[model samples]
Target: MPPERDQSTNPTGRQKSCARCVKSKRRCDLTQPSCLRCTRQHFTCSYPSRPAFNAIPVAEDNSPMPDSSIDNVASPFDMSLIQGHRNTSVQSRQDTCLLDLDVNAGLESIGILHDLRNTSPMPENQQTIIRSIRVPQAGECRWELTPSSYARISYAIDRMKQAPATMVLENQTPWSHPLLYEDCMPRVLQEAHATCALYLARNETNSAFFARHVIDRVKELTSSPPPTAPLDILARAHALILYQAINAFSGDLQLNAHVCPTFPHLEESIYALYASLQSSETPPSPTLISLYPATTARQAWRAFILRESSQRTLLILCQFMILLHLLQGRSYCFDHACVTSKITTSAHLWNAGSTIEFASAWNEKRHFLVADLDFSEVLEGAGPEDIDVFGRMILVTILGRDDMLGWFAERGGVF
Candidate 1:
C-alpha cells in the first residue's frame, strides 16, 4: 500500500499543484511564480482557483460521518481524488489543458493571428475572423529559370543597384506615383528612399557609417509601433520593401542577417493592409472614375490610387520574396497561385498625371485585369505598350525574359 502524503508543509492545510503539473501527472514542488516541473519544461505555470468549500452543497446531516464510512472515502490529497476533481471541474467549465498552454507563444508562431488582432476594427456587420493570408506555393506552376532568363535577371539586379541614383534625381519608378509631389509623400517613405540613396552612394570612406545607419534605420522602422491608418500602413510596407530589396540583394552577409528578422514585420504589415482593404469600402472602379465630375473624379482617383497601390505593393513583395528565395537556393515561399488580386496592366492608366488624364487613359487604353498570375489573356489581348514597367517586371519574373521577348516580337515591339 502507498504511504499517506503529509500536508503539514502546506500551512493553509491545502495542497494543490499547478494546472500544467496536474494535467501532465507530474509531481509539483508547489513553488511560487512557477513550479520546478513547469519551469524545467518551459510550460506556463497557472494554478486553478481553489473551489469555495462554503459554496459547495453540504450534506443535510451536520454530524460527522462514522469511521467505517470515512475509511471508504479517499483523502483530499490522494492522486485519484485530485484526478477525479480535475476531470469534473474541466467538464463543468468546458475547458481543457490546451487552453492552459502558452497562448502567446502559439500566437507568435502563427503571424496572421497577431496581425488580425492589430488590424483596424471592422464594422460590426463586417467583423469576421481572418485565419491566414495564403502564401504562394511552388507546385502550382513551373517557376524554373532558363540560363538566358537568369542572365536577364542578373541585369535587372544591376539596374536595381543603380535605382537609388534615379531616385536621387527625383525620377519616378514603377512603384512611385508620377503625380505625387515631394511634400505630399509620407515622411517614412522619404526616409527610406534617402537611406537607400545614401547606402548605394557609400564609398570606401563612408561605407561603414552608411552600413550602420542603414541597419539602425531598418531596425527602428520595423520595431516602431505599427501604423493604424491604411495609407500609413501602406507607406510603412513600401519603406520596408525598399530596405529589404537593398539588404537581400546587396551581397552583404552582415546586412542580410540584420534584415532577415524584419521580414515578419513586413509580412504582418502586408496582412494588416490587406485586411484594411477588405474591410473598408471598395474603391471606385476605373470605368466609374471616368463618369464622376472632375472634383469627384479626383477624389475617386485618389481612392483608386490607394487601393491599387496596396495591391501592387503586395504583388511586388510576393514577387521579391520568391526571387530572394530562388537566389538563396531555397524553396519558393509563394507560388503563382497565391497572386489572386487583380492588377492594372495599362501603363497610361497607372501613370496618369491628373484626374482628367486618368479618365482619358481609362477610356482610350485597352487595359487588362490580370489575376492569379495568369497572363494568357494579357498576352493575347494587350500589346507591349499596354503593359506597364511593374506589369512587365512581374511577367518577366514569372514567364522569363525569353517568353516576354517572344511576346514583344509578336507585337512588333522591341524588348
Candidate 2:
C-alpha cells in the first residue's frame, strides 16, 4: 500500500459554517458543516439550508453530534425563545402563532388544507373545515325573476329586522308583563302600519319600512283587487291597517277606535288596539319614528301587536310564534311583511334592549311549547291540494300533525 493515506488527512472537506450560519444566511462552506463559528455560537450545524417549501426545515437540532462537546442545540423555529418585538404573552402566543402560520404558509398550504378538508376520512366535526364553493349557473334559482317575487322577497327581508315587544318594555316602570306589553302595543302597531304605508308609497322621506318595490305590489293590488280571493282582502286589510297604525304612531290619531276597526273579524281587536294607543299619556311622536327605526320583522310585528292588541298577552304569543318561525327559517317572509308593514317608522313603539329581552324570553318559551304541542292533533281535515307546499310545511311543523308533517317532509314544498 503506497503510504496508506493518513486517515486524518481525509479529503471530503469539513462543514465550513455551522447549521445556524447556513440557515440565517443562505451560505455554505467546505469545513465540517457545523463549523467553528456555529460551534462557538452554539447552533446545530445543518446542510442544504434552503429546503423546498413543504420539505420540513432540517431537523438537525435533534441529531446527536459526533463531538458531545457543544451544548444541546434548539430549533430556531421555537417561538417561545423568539426575540421578536411583538409583546406576546403566553395567552396570546398560541392564537398569534396560528394566525401567523396561516398567513406565512402561503396559498399552497391553503389548497392542501382545502383538499384535505374535502377528502377527510374523519367525521363531520373534524371535517367542518370543508367549504362549499358556490358556482352559480344561470336560470338555476327556485323563484321566478318576476317583479312581484322581487317585491315579496325584498318586503320579506325588510320585515325580518323588526324589534320585539318585551324589548320595547324593559325600561318601563313596575315591569308587569301584561301592563308593559299592553301600554306599548298600540304605539308599536301604529308604528308598524306607518312603516308599511311609507314603504308602500315609495317615500324615502317617510322611512324605508317596506321595500320600495313593495309599492309596486301595492299599486297592483289596489289597482286590481283580487275579487275571487278572501286572502287578497286580508292582504289589503293588513296593508291598510298597517298604514293606519303607522299614522297613529306618528301622532296622526285620526284613526280612533271608531275608525273602520281594520277587517271585519278584527274590529274589536283593532278598537282595543286603538284604545290602548290613545291611552298613552305621552303618546308616541313622529320624532320618535325618526329616532328608532323599525327595520325588522320581529320589531315590526311586536310594535304593531303591542300597540294594536288590547290583549297584550296575545301580542307576546304572536311575538313568540313569529320568532320561532324566523329561527326555523319557515314563514319568515310572511311574518316579516306583517311586522314591517306595521312598525318601520315607529320609534315610540319599541326600544332596542327591551325588544331583545322579550325576544329572549319568548325564545325560551317557544322551544318548550313546540315540544309540548301534540303533533298528532294538527289540521286533520285539510285536503292535500288545499295547502301550498310552503303553507303545508309550516302548518304541519307548527301544528304537530305527524301525518301532515311526514307527508310534507317527504314531499317537500313543491308543485
Candidate 3:
C-alpha cells in the first residue's frame, strides 16, 4: 500500500490537538483526552477546546499579579485575529526554544537563584511574618510559640542589637509570673561577681583568660556570627545550657584554681584551703552572691595570707588555713601532728572549745599596730618568723578561745 495513509491527518480539518500537534501547527481532531496525532506520536494529549472562563476581570492597575493568571487573559472573542498570530508565534518559539536551549543552562540558573536566595539575609519584615508562625514545643518536629514568648524573643533580639552581649534564656519558676531575672540564668550574676572579685584581687591575666574562653563560648552559643544580635529560640536555649555548665563547675576549688588563676589572692586562698584540709575535711560550701566580709580588711588579709605581698608563703598559707577554718562552721583539734616533710604537716579537724576559751586566748595574743600594715615587713624573714607567729596564734586561739564566735559574727563569717 502507498505507505499506509497517515490516518492521523483528518480528511478535512481537526478540532482537538495535543502538544505535538500544537508544536507542528496541525489541526487536532479535538478529541476528549488524546488526539490521534498525539496518540500516534506516543504522547499523552488533551485539549481545552472551550476556553476557560474568568469570573473576575483582571484590574489594569499596577498591583502585584494574583495567583491565577490563566483566568485573566483577554477573551479570544474580542481579539481572535491577534490571538491567532500570538498563538502561532508562541507555539513556534516554544518548539525552537525547547529544542535549542541547553537544558543544563536552566538548571544552572535555578541553582544560582537558590544559592543567592539562601545566602541572602531575610528581610526584617519577612522575618517578622515567618516568626509569627508558631512551632510546636515538644514532638516530632513541630514548632509553636506563645505570644508572650514571641514578644520576649523580639525584645531580646533588639537588646542584642543595641548591645551585643550573649543572649540567655531563663525559665523562671512556675509559681512566679513576671520573670524578674532578665536573663534566667543566675550564673551570669555569679560570673560577673567572680570577675569583679578577680579584678579586685588583681589577677589581670587570669581574669582576661576566663573572660575570653567563657565569654567566647557564650557568644558562640548566643550569636551565629560572633557579633550578630541575640539569637533565635533554639540558640538562646543552647546558650542557657552553657550557663548551666558554668554554674555547676565554676566554684569547684581545684577547677577554679587550675583553670582561672587570675587573682593571685583568690587562687592562693583556694590553694591554701586545699593544702590545709585533712583527708576527711569537707570542701568549702558552695559560694553564693551574698557571701561576705566585703571590706578592705578582708582584702588586705587575703593579700597577706596569699603571700603575694610579704612573708614566707608557706607560713602565710598555714595561718590562712587555721583562720579560715575557724571562720567556717565547726573546727579542728590537733591531737597529734605528722610531719610528712620539713614543710608539710597533717592536722586533725575537731571541735573542742567554748566562746570563753577562745576569747581568753585572743585577748592575750592580740597585737594591733596602729600603723598601716605593711606586708613587705612580714615577708622579710618569711619562713620561721611567719610560721612561728601564725602557728602560735592559731594554737593558742583554738586551744583557749571564747571570743572567736564574736569575731566571726561581727564580720559575717565565711561559712
Candidate 4:
C-alpha cells in the first residue's frame, strides 16, 4: 500500500510519537530530529530507544538529501543536537520560573542561584560582601497610630505642605540654609527650588509645561550616576525629596503617578549619603560644639547641619510614604524600627544663621538628641522654645495634638 511506505528508516510498520507528546496525550506529527508539536511549543522532544535490529543505518542505495532539502526531509538521528535542544528548553523554563517568582515577590530576588555555574568555592561570598558594608543603625521608636493620632498627623501634613515652598522662598527649614542661594549650593538644588516655586504658582495654561519639566528633571536626577562626594549625594537626595513631596501633595494624578516609581531610588540615595556621613572623620555629635578655632568650629557646624538635614529629610520621606500609601488605599509595610537615627530637637541650634550663633545656641540652650521618630526625650528635657518646626511635627505625630498641647501648657508656653 502506497508502495510499502519507507520501511528502511522506521523498520516497524507504525510510526511512534515523541515521548513528550505521549506523556501529554497530544497528537505528534513525528518529525525526526524533533517532532512538530514539540518544535512549535519550544519543548524538548525525545523518542524511546529502538531495538538493535531497528537501529540499522539507512541503505547506501537511497541517496542522501541535499543541504537545501535537509530542513524539509527527516534527517537521521543525531544525539548531540537532541541533547543541546533539551538543555536549551530546560534553561528557558528555569528563566521563566525565575521571572514569575520575582514578579510575585514585589521586590528583587536574592541568593536563589548563588552559584549556578559552580565557578566559586564560596558560593555565598557575594552575600557576605553585601553584609560587610555597614549602614547607620536605625532607631527603635516604633509606634501605632490610633484614628485620632492619624488625624493629627494628617493635619500636621497639611500644615507641612506649605513648608517646602516656604523653605525654598525664605530658607526656613534646617536643610534650607540662608546661604543656599550662594555659590556653595549645588546647581541641582537651586533648580529644584525653582521648580518647586513654579509648581506652587502653576496656572491652567502652564500646568502641562510644569508637569513635563518636573517629570523630566526628576528622571534626570534619579537616572544619573550617583555622585562620589557625600555633599553632592545629599544635595541630589534633597532635591528629589522636594520633588517627591510636591508631586505627592500636588493633587495631580499624572504627576503623582510619575513620581511613585522613583521612591526606592530616593531612599537608596538618602541611605547612601547617611552611610558616607557616618564613615567620615568628622561625624556630627554634641562634642562637635567643643571643637576649637573659628575655622574648625565652622567646619564642625557645617558637618552638623549636613547630618541633621539628612536625618530630618529621611524622617519626612518615611512619613510621606506612609501618608501616600494611606491615601491610595494601600497598606504600607513600613519597618518602623529602621528610623532610629537621632535628630537635633533644639530650634536655636537648627536655626542658627552662623557658626558663632550655632555655638552660642549650643552653649546657651538645652538641646535634646531624640530618636528621629521618638518624642519622649524632647517632652522630658526640652521646652517648647527648644523644639523646631521639624521636631514639633514629629512630636505632634507621635503624641497627638492634645498631648502635645498639654506638653506646651506644662512648659508655660503656647502650643
Candidate 5:
C-alpha cells in the first residue's frame, strides 16, 4: 500500500473553492487564488467573502472581484458569468438572477433549480421527485421538482425567448384578456422551466425521468381543489401543452422510440391539456368574469397580460406541433386529430379590457371561416390573407415561415 502524502509542509490550511467546484461537487486542489481546475477550464474562480456556508469545506477569503467585471458576474437568469465573490456563500433572493416580473414577485416561487448533472437514476415506472422550494402556499400547493429541474426550466425559458411572447389566436373569449396580460409571464416561465428538463434531456432515461416529473407537477397543479376559472384553466393548460410539446419534440429518437412512444404519450397529454378547457360550447358565467377584476390600472394591466401570455403559449404549442410534423413529413393533422376543432368557437377572442368588453367580445358570435372545419376543409375555402382557426392554420402558414411574422411586422400587422 502507498503511504499518504504529508499535509504539514507550508500550508494555507483550508482553501476556498469556487462556486463551480462546489456546484460540480468536485474536490478543490487549493492552488492559490485560481485553482488548477478553474484555470484549465477558464471558469471564473470566485470565493465568497463570509465563512463557508455549504457542507463542502471552503477556505476563508473576503476579497471582492475586480469592479470592472462585477457587472458581468453570475445571475440566476444567466449563471454563465459565475457567481462572483460575496460575503455570503449563497446569494440572497434579491441578488438572485430569478427576479420576478410581477405574478411571482410577492408569491413564493417554490423549489430551487435541480442540478441535472448530479441526478440519480430512477426506474422506468417510478419517478424521482427530489425537492421543490415552492411558495409557502397553504401547504396544499407544494410541488416537488426533482434535482437538476432548474436546468430544464432555464432551458425552456431560453427557447421561448426566440419568438414573441404575446399574441392571442383566433378565439372567442376576451374576458380573460386582463388575466392574459399580467399573469402570463410567470406562468410561461414556470412551464418553460418544467418542460425544458425533459425536452432537452441528454439521454433517454433522464428524459423519461424529467417527463414524469413534469406530469407529476401538472397533476399536483390540478389536484383536489381543481381549477375553477378560465384563467386558471389557461394557466394550467399552458403548462400541460408546453410539457406535451417539449416531450414530443425532445429530439431523442431512442427515448421517443424504444423507451417511450411519442404518439401515445403525446396524444394522451394533448387530451390532458385540452381537458375541461371547453366543458360546454357556451362561454363562462358572468359571475366568474367579475370575480377577479383589477382594483387599479396596475391590476388591470396585469390582468390584460394573461391574454398574450396564455394566447402566445397556446399558439406556440399549436404551431410547433405542426412544424414538427412538417419537419418529419408526417401526415397527422392537428385540426382533424384531437380537440383543436374548438378554434372557431375560440376565435371570438379579442383584447378586451373590462368584463363588459369581454362580454361584448364573447357575445359577438364571430365565426372564423375555418372554425368547426378540419385543416383540409378550411384550406379549400381560405383566401391567402384570411386568418383561419386559433392555432392550426396559422401554424401551417408559419411552417413555410421565411420570417413571415417579421414580414407581417414590416407590413404593420401583428402576425
Candidate 6:
C-alpha cells in the first residue's frame, strides 16, 4: 500500500511561496506580513492561515527507533503516527517506513523543511528525513476566529475611561454622597446606572442611543407602583437627579449637535418625581420614611442615609419645579411646599467606611437639625454657592421669578 501522508507538512505546497511564485513554480523567500519576492515583483504576497500542520504535537508516547533503522524510513508521512490518519489500519513499523521518494522530490528540491531531505547519498538520522506530502484528513482544526480576550479588556478600559466624567459630584466633602449617590443605595440601582453610563459613553456613535439609555433607566424608576426598598428609593431619586444634570450639560455643550434632535422630555420627567409623602399620588409611591415605619433611635439613625439621599433628590426637584413654573409656565409633580420640611445636611458625608460608622456618626452629629433645608432662606438670602443642586435650582427659581416680576413691572408693576 502507498505510505500514508504526513498531515503535518504544508498541504498547499505553495504556502510559503508568493502567489506568483506558486503559479510560476519559482522559489519564494517567505517573509512576514508580506514576502520579498512578491514585494519586489509588485505582487501581493500572503501566507495561508495554517502554513503547515507542524503545529500538532506528535504522540509523545511513541518511542524513537535506532539510527540504523532511521535512513530506511525516508518520510515522516509513512508513520501512521501522523495525527490526521487515525482511522488508517496499523501496520508493522518496517512497512510504514515506505515513503514515496518520487512524491517528496519537489518539496525536497524546494528545500521546504530542509532537514527532511537527503543532504548526502547516505543519510545519518531519521531527523534527517524530509517531510513532503500533506494528507487531506477527515477533520482539520485551526485557530479559533472568535473575538479575542484583548478585545473585551479594551472595551472595559474604554467604559472606565468614560466613568469619572459621567459620575461627577457637585460636592467633594466626605459627608456628600459620591456622584450624589448615597453609598447605601441598592446594588441593582448602581449597576443600572453603570450600564447606562457605559452605553451613554458611546454617544459618539449614536447620540439618540445614548439618550435612550438614560431615558429608559428613568422610565424603569417611574413604573406604576415604584420600588419599595429605602435604598432602592434613594437610588431611584439619585438616578433622576443625574439624568437631569446630564441632560442640562449635554444641552449646553451641544454634545449631540445636529446629529440628533434634543431628547424629548429627556429631563422633564425627572422634575415630575417626588418622595411618596410629597407625591399625593392615589396611593403615593414608596419613600424611606414609610419603608421602615420604625420609631427607634437606631432605626432612625439607620434610615438617615436613605432620608438624606431622598431629601436631597426631592428637594432639588422642588426647586426645579418652582423654576420651571416661573420660567416656562410648566408644572410637574410635587409642589414647592411639598418638600419644604425635609431635613438635609451641610456636607454630603460619604466618608464613613460602613453602615455602622454612618449610623454612629449620624447619632453623634445629627447634622440635619442644624443643616435642615429652608427654601425661603435659600430664595431670599442665599447666594450661588450657598446650597447644592437644590441651591442652584433655587437660584434659577429666583432669577425666573424676578424675570416675571420685571415683565409685570414693565406693564406698570402690577401683580
| Overall lDDT per candidate, in order of appearance | 0.55, 0.28, 0.27, 0.55, 0.35, 0.36
List, residue by residue over 1-415, the lDDT tens digit for candidate 6: 1112224444644334456556645444345555433443334666545543444444443444323232232331221221123222433332222111111112222111122223345333322222221221221111111122112122222322333244542222111255344434465456556744554455566776766766666556555354554445555544544544454335423322311122223233232334344453232212222222234433544455445555555544443332222111111222123334354433223344454554444444323332223334333432332234333322223333344345345555332
Question: For candidate 1, lDDT tens digit of each residue in 1-415?
Answer: 0011124333355667788766654445565667544543346789756443334233343543233121232321122221122333312221111112121111222121121132345445532332232222321111123344354455345445555555566545565554443337677778888987787677879877877887888878877888887767877877787777667656555566654466577667656666676668874474645455688667766766766777777766655554443343222332112234567778887878788988777777777776545667877788878887777776665455677889899999887
In model 1, the Cα lDDT at residue 46 comes to 92
TM-scores for the candidates: 0.61, 0.19, 0.14, 0.60, 0.32, 0.35
* Residues 191-222 of candidate 3: C-alpha lDDT, one tens digit per residue: 44343344234354575565455555444443
**Which ten residues in a row are the worst by lDDT in model 3?**
343-352
Which residue runs of candidate 5 sit more than 4 Å off their true CA positions? Answer: 1-237, 244-262, 272-322, 333-340, 344-349, 353-370, 373-415
TM-score of 4: 0.60
What would the per-residue lDDT of candidate 4 be over residues 1-415, giving only the tens digit for each residue? 1111235445676756688766755444455667544543345778776545554454444433223211221221222221112223312221111100110011111211111112234333222211121111221111122345345566546645676677667864544555534447777887887887788789889888998888988888877888877667767877877787777667666676654476577657645655665566755355546535778668767777767776776556555554543333222333222244557778898787888888878877788776534455666777888876776666665555787789889999887
Over 4 Å off in model 1, which ranges?
A: 1-163, 180-183, 286-293, 334-338
As a TM-score, model 6 comes out at: 0.35
Tens digits of per-residue lDDT for model 2, 23-57? 44423222353432233233465644432233323
Model 5, span 310-334: residue lDDT tens: 4344444443443333222121233
Better of 1 and 3 by lDDT: 1
In angstroms, the error of model 3 at 139 is 47
Off by over 4 Å in 3: 1-316, 338-415
Per-candidate clash tally: 3, 45, 28, 2, 37, 9
* Model 4, residue pairs in steric clash: 138-340, 139-340
| Best of the two (3, 6) by TM-score | 6
Ranking by TM-score: 1, 4, 6, 5, 2, 3
For model 2, the run of ten residues with the poorest summed lDDT:
98-107
